[model samples]
Target: MNTVPVNFDFSVSSVEVARRLIGVTVLVNGVGGRIVETEAYDREDPASHSFAGPTSRNITMFGACGHAYVYRSYGIHWCLNFVCREEGHGAGVLIRALEPNTGIELMQKRRGMETLRLLCAGPGRLCQALGVTREHDGMRLNTAPFELLLPDQPVAEADIVAGARIGISKAVDIPWRFGLAGSRFLSRPFGRSHK
Candidate 1:
């Protein structure tokens, strides 16, 4: 039987929701991975796609919480975000990185690299590894082909680290980016194509 919670905490603010997601296992298709990094975005934040209100592109951000809001970045790679907060609240938490748990070969094939860390170490890379795209937008995260398996308990605050989100100019001081402390799966702060 599946041990993951069917309902994740979606009532909390984007920041809290991001913090709570660390350590949860995300399953897509036949592959699964532990979510190691995340970034929170709320309507109030200028960096959020919903900040200027929903458009045809961000419709999924206004639907249900705990749903995937996959979108392409720079027309080159797809990024994955989890819709959060109340229905219509317009909030999302980006799944910035993950630790591959299954189907490494497929992930490598999709990402075009064999390095374990690079397989799913960034928002784009993770989505590419899982074959997620705008087509998967609005898909329920607790169901098949897109599942989230919660941990027994939230990762301890001490084991978690907060930092400013990368590659964004506005709301740069919010410190909404969260990652498992010392985790190798976090999108590296330095180096090209890292953020």
Candidate 2:
């Protein structure tokens, strides 16, 4: 069993949290699925919203750990992230993709499409499908409207892959992006060498 500690401790580094989240099932008001892809970011990373310090938009990231940091990408679709590390540490894991297994019909209705793979393949699409928006920012992940459950089946280490993050101009080569190996639900394919 892959047990490198799966307590969802947000006090750890963002990288560790991102890797551990791979097989975890997440539900937002009873609509979500197993997290398949994620990207880690900290206050020191230039690509992170917290790199320059806390702002009104990124203030949630600086708050307590294990909370939602919802934001809009390109002024359009909302993206969801899980804040990590200590309070005022400004670190989080971007929830990039999911293998949706719950509330499939509702997700299809909200996304306006019937394709299962495309429903939660990307951060923006995942948020839209789960009805996550700015309203969820700063909300605790352990409370109502959110449920993060440990995997029933332990995930194997060899099944996880790492690569560079996508849609960013800075810190492009950090290789902080993590995903479940061989999962077709990923937002984008990882390079062969990433494994």
Candidate 3:
């Protein structure tokens, strides 16, 4: 079913929708590479995490728009987001890390580990090397093959670099986390001692 091209357009330009989602490619079909290292959760500020509005596990971040909001952090990690403002507005953008490309032996046997940059880097190791659970909570990021591909060179807001958010304690200062600076598959830099 690899015909590609389904992008459920969401009226882009949220900071170019977070720097056009860097080298876009997040394949987890059979499990492997599709390098992705995202992190841009800004919704007119208020220190996001849906800025305390939609309940019931962030009601798919207010629904409609390119969805997919699997949550479950600190209770044993499982955070993968991408539901940006539109249907009702709440905003999203938190993939975190990935760079497997095409099933590195089922992502090193589901991240049992053998080092491949410790498989996926962050966001709970890219949702445990792309098995993204919590029942794929609120899926709809363009469907089939769990999609989100738009690369060809599109990550440059001066190469991005925002702060805050990482093991959050709440609002920390609201710098709106974003990355890619020296991207070794970012997500492990937190608030830099508040600069």
Candidate 4:
């Protein structure tokens, strides 16, 4: 219910900047949605998409800060990403999951489910629930309507845990993924470290 002041929009050029998005809150109001769970994926890391360098699919990541870079995976499953770092920097934060709040009916209708966990539980699911599509690519997060607003109280780095990214085979060696600790809203526990 509390709105926080807008700081310098995060520069999406650096992977380190993207990895720090763990505690940030993503808000979608037009559809009556508030998402809480997220996992940060830094650039420069071999596991990151930007690490392979920017392509037409990833150009938004190389642009200015505070924007969306929604993309589809395997010709299905739309994934939501938040641009990070300064303009021209090829870094962005991948929103891996979310905890739904508000508009249970709308979310359920969109997702075609009634279970609480099924609504906005994973990146693709979250995107589906909030009506995020490829059309939302490159939208500014700090502008209005749709934005990734950080809460007045951050979850803190110490409280976050790191582990290998899910559903990725390449660069699994890099431990750059970050998520909230002990949150059922999280996609899954990352081995024993997360427990």
Question: Each prediction's Cα lDDT score?
Answer: 0.84, 0.92, 0.66, 0.68
How are the candidates ranked when ordered by lDDT, highest leading?
A: 2, 1, 4, 3
- Best-fitting candidate, measured by TM-score? 2
For model 2, residues 1-195, the per-residue Cα lDDT tens digits are 222234668889999999989999888888999999999999999999999998999999999998999999999989999999999999999999999999999999999999999999999999999999999999888887888888878578899999999999999999999999989899999985365
Kindly list the per-residue Cα lDDT of model 4 for residues 1-195, writing each as its tens digit. 333235634743334544456556666664533333444555556656677777999888778777788889888899988777667766666777676766768888999998876677778888888888888898877655575556567667667777766777777755556667766777666664431
Candidate 2, TM-score vs. the true structure? Answer: 0.95
C-alpha lDDT of residue 128 in model 1: 89
Model 4: what TM-score?
A: 0.84
Residue 135 of model 1 has an lDDT of: 84
Badly placed stretches (over 4 Å) of model 3 are: 1-27, 32-40, 46-63, 68-81, 88-90, 98-102, 106-114, 122-139, 147-172, 175-186, 189-195
| Candidate with the greatest lDDT versus the true structure | 2
Of 1 and 4, the candidate ahead on lDDT is: 1
Predicted candidate 1, C-alpha RMSD: 3.4
Clashing pairs in 2: none
- Candidate no. 1 TM-score: 0.92
